[model samples]
Target: MRDRIEKRMAEIAVIGLGYIGLPTAIMFANAGFNVTGYEIRKDVVERINSGKAHIVEPDIDDLLRKVIESGKLRATSNPADIREKDVYIICVQTPLREDRTPNLTYLESAVETVAKAMKPGALIVIESTIPPLTTVRMAEFIEELTGLKPGRDFYMVHAPERVMPGRIFRELVYNSRILGGITPESAEIAERLYRSFVKGQVFRTKSTVSEVVKLMENTFRDVNIALANEFAYLAHQYGINVFEAIELANSHPRVKIHVPGIGVGGHCLPKDPHLLVWPARDDFGLIRLAREINDGMPLLAKDLLFEALRTINLPPEKAVVAVLGLAYKGDSDDTRNSPASAFVEAIVDDVAEVRTYDPFVEGTHGSLEEALRGADAVVIATDHTVFRSLDWETLGKLMRNRVLIDGRHVVEMPPEGFVFKGVGRGEY
Candidate 1:
């Protein structure tokens, strides 16, 4: 199996061609493997086959086109097209339920598909972030469906992806990977497979530890951001700039403070913490409280927007609010678990009108001018790089009322003649 993988003779199947799956397939294909991508969305399959990327990421289009033109990658909607592949990499989403439990439906369905299609000696790799013990349970589930004993008839490994959305292609190559196996051989085989393209250090451990490590990494960030948000609230009370305070505090050798924002967003930070604590019997309130703090940040943004309107003597129902940036973060099209969406939801019912403009996201207002024209207030949500250099003095002329609310701290200075209220800029 190692020889076939090293020789690029192992045919690879990547299931679920979303943000993670498509890029993963492209990487493997560009590494000289014959890769097949399976996605239920026919439109996505058609788009990929034609060398176009549905998601926005740096260098994805050029990389995807290279592999597609070389005949190394082919995307398909049919299950038969992926049958009997030597490698199966599942990159499906494991979103949280409405009640905050880890929803494993997508992951399970992908596993069932692989179980039905995989041969006896195929290597199964799950790149989805999931609850601890899920990989072991999944191997048992596959055994029930395929009657193939794991680590005997087949090998299984939990190799969670550790890349951010904007820097996915670059990070996929540079980021250190953690491969957790149910057995020693499973980890060894998966490491060999990824080392073909991965240039960063690779670590091997048990499946459960790998799961905890991924969740812990994100959870740590979430918790620290929550602490930063608390500091933002304190700044509002103390009538100071949290950013300035954080800068000075971070000057201390041991102090490293995270910047406050509207909320934590993206796929991992918001959801992985919940998945980490969901399966545990009992957890101290710290993790859950941190999640609540982060979740409530959008509401804080809403409050700031409404307060700006009140200061301008405008009622909430009469305000035409324009929200700039809808994606979770800057320079990316992904909106899963985005705090911007939550902030919009919080204000959509109260505000007279809400206009959204995100350059990378589709189905938004065509231009920033269009969204701000005649709007009573403008809220900066995503902190896109372009937003940093915006000529606010000129853009303010387009608004009906010059009310600027910086939800993500995009505006460093308050423009003259505008009622500005930023998340941690209490001096405004």
Candidate 2:
């Protein structure tokens, strides 16, 4: 089986062609495998077939075009197209429910689709971010659906994705991967498949550990960012700049501190902490606290905006505020659980009007001029590179009032004639 896969005879079907799935399918196809992308959205399927991507990521367009033009990759909404694939990889989402529990609805659906199509001796891999023991439970689920026992009749492995949005393509090749399988043989086979394209180390472990490792990586970042956010709050009370203090402290070799923003966002950071703590035996007090701190950042930003408004003697109903960015983080357009979205939700009803603009995000204002025109205040939600070098003088001229709120702390201080306030900076 390994030899056949290495020889490019194995057909790989990647289910759910969203952020992770699309790039992954493209990578495998570029590596000489016959790849089929299964998507529930017909528009996504059509776009990929037409060599266009539905999601925005850096350098994916040319890669998608090359893979499609090479005849190695195609997408379909029909499950029948994936019935005979040699390898089945489930890349669907595993988001949290409203109660902050692990939502396995999408994962279960993906498993059902694979169960209907998979044959004996076929390898099944899950690349979604799920809680510990989910891979084993999914393996049991496949057994109950198809009456095929894992490791004997079929293979199962958990290989959660570990790439950020903006650098997904590059990290997919270079990043070290964790492969946790139900059995040693399952791990070995999946390792061979990933080794084909992965330039970094492929570490093998039990399926549960791989799940925990993925959660741990994201949770660590979340906790650290939460600490930074707390520091920012403390700095505000002390009337100091948190960025300067963080830089000076981080100068020590071991004291690395993350930057505080309006809030933590994106699909992973905001939700993964909950996944880690939801199933744990203990209450996970620290983890819960960290989530709360990060979650409160949007409200903190709202307070800052209101304070700026009061300083200028403008009422909420009379303020025309412009929100700068909507995507969770910088450059790329992935807005899942975005802090900018929360900030907008928190203040949209109170403000006279809220205009939004993002350079890379669609359905926003056509130009910055439109969003900033006649606005009394502008909130820099996401730290997109374009937002860093804005001509504040010219843009401020277009606004009715000159108030700048830097939620991400990416903007410089005291725009010559404008009233400026940043997340961590005390006063200016």
Best by lDDT: 1
**Cα TM-score per model:** 0.98, 0.98
Q: Write the per-residue lDDT of candidate 1 for residues 323-394, one digit (tens) a residue.
A: 999988888788888898999999999989999999988999999999999999999899889999999888
Give a tens-digit lDDT track for model 2, residues 206-247.
999999999999999999999999999998899999999999
The number of clashing residue pairs in each candidate reads 0, 0
Candidate 2 Cα misplacement greater than 4 A, ranges = none
Model 1 TM-score, 2 decimals:
0.98
Cα deviation at 125, candidate 1, in Å, is 0.3
